[model samples]
Target: MRRNTRRRPTGARRRTFAAVALILGGGGLVAANTYASAGEGDSGGRVQDQSGGDQAATISCPDVGQQLTDVPGEARADVDKALANLDQQITEAYDRLTSTRQEQAQDGNFVRNSILGPLSEKRTEVIGQIKIDVKRAGGTAPEALDGLAACTEISPAQAQKNDGGGDGDNQDGDADTANPGTGQDDGGQGGEQQDGNGNGAAGPFAADFVDITKVQPNVKAKPRRTGDASTGTFSVQCGVNENKVFNTDNLIVAPGVDNGAHHTHDYVGNQGVDAFASNGDLANAKTSCSEQGDKSSYYWPVLRLQDGTKEFDAEQQGGGLEGNVGKILQAKEAEITYIGSPAGKVVAMPKFLRIITGDAKAFTNGTANANANWSCTGFEDKVQLADKYPICPQGSSVVRSFAFQSCWDGQNIDSANHRAHVAFADAEGNCGNGFKAIPQLTMRLVYDVPAPVIENGQVKNPYAVDGFPEQLHKPITDHDDFINVMDEDLMDEVVECVNAGRQCGAGAGEQPQEPQQPEEPKQPEEPQEPQEPQQPEEPQEPKQPEQPQEPKQPEQPQEPKEPKDKPAPQAPQEPQDEPELAPEASSADADKDRAKKPGEAPDAPSEASSAPSDAATRTQEAGAPDDARGGETKARTTSPAETSDTGVEAQSEETQPQPQAGTGSLASTGADLWPAAAGGVLVLGGLVLLIHNRRRNMTTN
Candidate 1:
């Protein structure tokens, strides 16, 4: 049986990658290579790859940014350091794909590309296929998705051009590099990059991280249940080298830190949680990072995983998490944390979206308007909690904004919407010893993988993509209770017939059962109807036997549902991590924050919410982007610069008037947008349906 092939990166993304190559590299045989490791002749600070290992050579790019001149030690280390961090990510991803294609698993042994390997051998193949486009002039920069929203349309000419190029070939059309205001090839733009005398400017996307999505499998693994801890033997194995496991003898032999040990601050080696955020200021060991409450609001934390690879804070979106557990975009070493029922596998969310929840102001728009009821301190009904931060008994308000506000989960903070909280840090620098804020956050490319189906003593996903892995992503951090709840609300209705006799779209509502109840046992009206009892319509083909019914008794005799009898159950609330205390950011800060975007909204409309669906209304108010009815959610609009051709829009409650175009049909949240999914497409007021039957087969990354 044939299998589905992987969705290759579009020429746009590849070409963009190539352009990244051009801006970062120069004076080389290859003009645009995919990866950015410096070559043998590279002299500027990029680390040269001299190992001559199986690793493929990365295309080098010179550091090209407004304030940057020389490559930061960290960026160079990302390419040259221990284990070829970036290459390992790419190659390992492909190795898993090959295994899935070859059907090579046997019994209990699973041969996935381990931590030390590259993502794929196909690196050159995939990267080489990128397309390059040079806009002569008068071309505007196409918009990009915010941390998670999306949109996708092209100019009439580009659409025609794209259609012509759609014959299964992928190309990257990247423009060449020049100064922001000046157009020159004098190699001047390349040197403008930061001197690395200090950390460089954050890239539009995270820097130097690997994407594990290409190897994702469509089928989920049946969660396995191994023996519980009882046997006095507990084995903890992850993508770590044997050296990582603590050995009593080895411990005695090697008690000191090895300068040669894998981890180095400069390398973007780990992409787990926010490891860099936890680092001690280079000044000294005693003066390590002030508690989480002390670090600079703008410091770019490095996320490290249990396996040891890392991701720069800037690259969190696509890099997966930095730790082993709960990290969607993994950064480093980690032991499997919590797997849902059935064990070894999990159902991951489709997107890793970021959204704006609220600021300390009351929005003028309707309640459904993106900024209505925020938990911001000065916003209506919000209490001041900044003073209580750092659990300080005194001067509580003096705490770092995130600590007081609880930006991680909005409840602790003052956000109104749940989807977006705070720009990682927007509060005051009133606190001591903090760095500048960093915000050019963007999501990484990712895909799903199912457990391999077991066939003839082998187990694997039956539907693995031909060139991708059957399973990818370590495991999701959240149980997605919201998804569970939403699914519950729509489960019965999705399969039912609508009043129009059309199949319900997903779970819209339960069909009217009162009229369908079995006919009340009619008192046999004897001969009155005998005249019609004659031929019974000439032996009509037997209508199939009455279908089965639920265990509940007939509805007419049953009681009415009391949907709104009591105050409704509140939606789950997240804790806030920052307080609203600081001065607003500078224009420079605003420029850096405009990069991330949310993903697509559903391709349908929600109906107006009625009293009966008040519970869902409350859900929407709690932070869900959609209303309960699916079609009746609020509408949000964005500037053209804030949206992308892929239909994603990046917006924020805190930032003012960033670029946005067209209304936000963005159901922009997370891979597991459970609450919104249950309600379907809930625009604030009005929405557009972007879906058509024809594109159902088109793939989304």
Candidate 2:
């Protein structure tokens, strides 16, 4: 009943499930932090590794993937171009889904919306299959698509773009867009803001600010496949604003177990999700913590960083990302413009937000830090049982004792110059053990996309340009918007079924002839008075009576003319809450109702069987013995036999009334509309693939 309320999700839900990705201050950690990114590569492939230290020996697990973190990105886009194309397509789809509303308001994301109808679920499955298709093509298994892959190596130009320097309205501060492929500014890169590139990093700024239009993912297919596979351009965005993620799953280790150099080896790729560990490994931390399906921060250190830069020591506890950050305070020169960073992963999956407190130094905190692990998430914080922001995430921890070691290093240590602030804990509660920690800010940290598509078999990459937040928002909008249209199409089918039942079946007409009234029981002529015994006496006197017999008023009063004027009015019937007649019933009439059932046309020749099906049946039945055909004859129309119920077959074209063909103009317009999304998918993929591969030798440097 709600007017067109049912619709496909536009990935606006990602905003709702919004987890801020904060690219925090960079630095190194001690013993405990070093062990997080440990994966060893081996031929058997089941090979896994760990930080080669006492820490590695302490933590024990059966399988390697189990030891890895399940980050957000399952939807795969291996090369930079692939990532860009996917980003463009997703954003475009969203624009169609929520052209009229915004994410924070009405729209939901792919995962949530897909649950609404059949196609939604199917959409999710198709994407998963695509990942398999690409993997089967001999590509390296991708890092999880959802969130696991962290950014690394931003181009100088890309870094400047983050500073908010650009020309255009994006620099003016308007993030929301009704136009396809854009979104309203949410205070980050989505609004009017200076472009965050080159010298533009910090000019007038807008969160919705991004300029991906230069890439133009809104494309079409060519009449024929060009050898290079180039079809159309795909607009691309550079930052979080432009990335409208969807059904992100966990890109996994089906990739077989790996065993490779560890401890002192430079990681080949984003070591964040390696499936193997070195011979020695640090135990993944486990606390009584739970979040959006993730439990235990067992692989915390590795899952958080995508730089292929592994630097943590799981052995000493208070010395990993958090701890090293504390140390950076003392070791690094101060920047008046602190460019304070936020915790991006924590910001994205609200479920991961949590609160924790421990001593500022490995020496002071290690004693109690082992058990001091604490956590809380966005929702828990919202209702306020805890004291953190609803936007933060939750996680477990590994302290000094995790490696089965007890460093009673004399308590008076601030070697890291760390001081904790109540803000560091979670969306819930917080405690300051003296570590000056600022939630990191969200920013673009890397650029590498998927491979370009092949035309008639050659390669062409399309997503050549990158955009900022303002630029990114529109794409997300477009992505969702298109999906919404798809949702509408699905609903139209439901209405079609309902109409068929009402228009072509028995329900379309009056109930079969009201039961014919039972014939009034014939009454014995008012019982002839028993011939009185007088008849006996009369026999003897017959001779004398000859004269008067005719005159005797027939003793029986002439049966008074039966009264023709009165018959009890049929008792007024009670009101029945009648169902409204169907739209087609207006044509039904008594003449039609009397026809014989479809296919029951008597053995008579066509000319003689002139009566309609209903008429023939009713008339023929009426011709039966009078005792059986006592009801009054009446004409009524019956509905045509519907194939589902009566064996009646579909009528030939000649017998069917023609539906007005859609106008030529309307038909043409619809035809074009149908190809937009499909064509866009392929075009964007080809273009993005080429551009992404341009950067990779695909050979390890």
Candidate 3:
């Protein structure tokens, strides 16, 4: 009736309504996604609080020592004590922060009021004392030092970024994909339960580990060696802390302070090393090294399996009480090698020189000074991870390697920050800022333990390196300490050998001679055989009886000639055909001997030196730095010389390696923004269609 004259609801009107609905729906999705992205970006890379609020994951303070470059020698002791107190204050505050999580969840200001406020106050007092110490010692403390007293809280995400995402967890909630379960039983100490946040007494979140096989090869090529390069290598047979030489003290960092490291360290070289040990004590102490000449103290954080086993330090301050718990794992192999500079001749390390490589607080301090190198035995050639603990494949042992700084300032044996006195060489292997090249200490530690398991975002039978309470046992906090205690004669010999480009050390002499001994007889025989014929003719002319004696003399030489020709030629041929064949053969034989007698010396010098060539080849082929892991050759934010405000020369930026891109952060960003961007496009398209339909409807009307 009315429809006969009135216009019915047109298809254009229906299309207009559909387009409007599409625009509304797409706009809502884009807005929601934008809000979510903003929220995540604001999280500041911190571990999300399980109680549904954002809280600090760890405490961070300015490194006061890094700024005290010119503390007078007299003030160092007082300043050191004050600095150690600062660390203690932070440790106490961290304990409070972790223990009062419920309080933090209840009150937003709890961390600031109950934890950080008190910590800042304590640090301020300590900083004031440090200033007074320097002033009293006729040195000036920077007024800017006062500003360093205040500390702030950092999120795990921020820390991970600073560490270049070494912990293997992406901020985009992709940890489940990064770490997959192997269906293996939790094999170490059993019965340890993780809290809801994936932390326990000593933590290593499931995100802290990665399937090593999944990591891309990041080892760079070795620095090119020049004519002045020190190509020789000096290795020492340091038993793998077999005698249980473990301590939680850092002699170089916090002398005279107990529990200085707040974690256990496996010490191998010096027998009497502790926070209070004087240089004299180290020099006179017995050593774990096969050569008593190498009394240098070598120590690093001990690795432990979280299997519910109580260790000697379990109840001690630097152990379980400080959050370093679990069954300590002894390294199956500990290789300590001192290689010469690749740029110039290496001088002997100054006796009593203190060197601390890798920051012990790297998890909190950031990776500017972090020098951790982790990989598996079979995969070390392919990849090395700086931040993540590798879940090594079956039959592969976990490897932790450290390459100490090799460039030494001509003046200081030790600097206030410890790092200012030494620096790593450039990518081209040249030392900068007039720093002389010194023997580079490279350490390789292998642990034979069941691979840690992760399932449903939980880690089982987790293994972690010992570290500060706030550090959460992250692998990036792994570090090593060294104090040169080598006797003058031994040090001189090391320098001579390195300069001469000869392999010399605990096992160098024993193994190389065996390979060359089979070749030695061939040389003497060539000259002796010609002399033998002439001698026989002369003897025969002198007397017929003498002829018999001359024949006997020739026979003696001939006897060795027969056997030497037979096996000597064959032995030399085997070595020539495959240089590594002799060493592998010798290693196999040594392994048998070792298997037969378990109580015998764990590492024989011959066995240790047998594969020196092969090891050297691997070191070069893997593109590892001559001084440390090749992957650690990142650009330094602070120059070693610039760490001192005094007349120390500044290191040239051109000499430092450029920071590589992919090495900085591993979190995926572009892929995450795709869905949001796509929705935005859809919303725009819907708006365009709605406008077109509305215009058509208007025309029809």
| lDDT values for all models | 0.17, 0.18, 0.60
lDDT of candidate 3 over 1-701, digit per residue (tens)? 54577778778877777777777877887888788775453221222333444566668777787777788999898888888899889899888876775576567778888888988998899899898899999999988899988878754334333242223222112232122112112222111123322335336765566676665555444555554556555777666654445567777878987777777787777756667677776766666666768888888888877766555565677877887766666664577877666566888788988888777776656556666777776666456666678887665667787778888897888988777888877666677778888878877776666677665344677888888887777677778888888998988988877665556775453111111112223322234333333432321121121112222222221221222232421122111112221132133322122121111112222321222221332222122322252212331111011122221111112112111111111233444566677777777888889889878777977
Identify the candidate with maximal lDDT: 3
Provide the TM-score for each candidate, comma-separated.
0.17, 0.15, 0.64
> What's the true lDDT of residue 545 in model 1?
12
Model number with the top TM-score = 3
Cα lDDT of model 2 by residue, 132-170, tens digit: 545565443334432222211111122112211211121
Candidate 1 per-residue C-alpha lDDT over 535-596 given as tens digits, one digit per residue, 9 for 90 to 100: 23311211111011111113211111211221322211111211121132223322122222
RMSD of each: 33.0, 43.4, 19.2
